[model samples]
Target: IVLQNCMDTNEPDSDGLTPLMHAAAGGHEEVVGLLLSHGARLGDRDNRRRSVLHWAVLTYREAVLRLLLKHAATDDPLLIDAYDESGCSPLHAAIDSGFEIGVSILMEFGVNI
Candidate 1:
């Protein structure tokens, strides 16, 4: 229905979270891919100014994080270092969340500590 209706993929909810943010938070890689293919903005921030990469790392969504990184690699390459309102970068969020794999992935993508 979303695809057929051509729904606004970048539309945020009351919390300022778009479908991409929710999908990344839930570790829904396929949904993230679908949304991205439909032009979902990877840099969209939530109410807290947390990007989809931040949400993916905070939630320990390894697959979603990878997918996001893959797209971001060619597009907005700086997204890996994006900071939220709290000044927490995706790398910071991943480390603080104790997600080793997520941290490793972020580092591999050239995200500085």
Candidate 2:
């Protein structure tokens, strides 16, 4: 409900992570969808240059990962292929973090190897 107010859904917090990133990290699939619907930038990255997909994968948010993937347009491969400060793509992060489901989902989405 608060999101329905005149608030900037893309506003980043002190950590440079927007609400969509937070929701993705916490596995809040519904909230992530809501934020996206509100115009949250799917390609928005944090201070580390990690996209929302990275946050979801890093935290093992399988459902959120899938949701983000489904919403990503063909031209939005950058979201799946983004590399963070540590030089890790969401796929790399998923593998490193042992998010097995995420790895498969990311691959299924055609994320660059």
Question: Which numbered prediction scores highest in lDDT against the true structure?
Answer: 1
Give the residue spans of candidate 1 off by over 4 A: none
Q: Over the stretch 1-113, how does candidate 2's per-residue lDDT look in tens digits?
A: 54868789999998899999999999899999888887888988898888998899888998998999988855375677888998988889888888888999998988887
What is the TM-score (0 to 1) of candidate 2? 0.93
Question: Can you tell me which runs of candidate 2 are displaced by over 4 Å?
Answer: none
Give the per-residue lDDT of model 1 (tens digit) for 1-113.
Answer: 57779889999999999999998898888989999999999988899999999899989998889989999999899899999998999998888879999989998889977
Which residue pairs does candidate 1 place in steric collision?
none
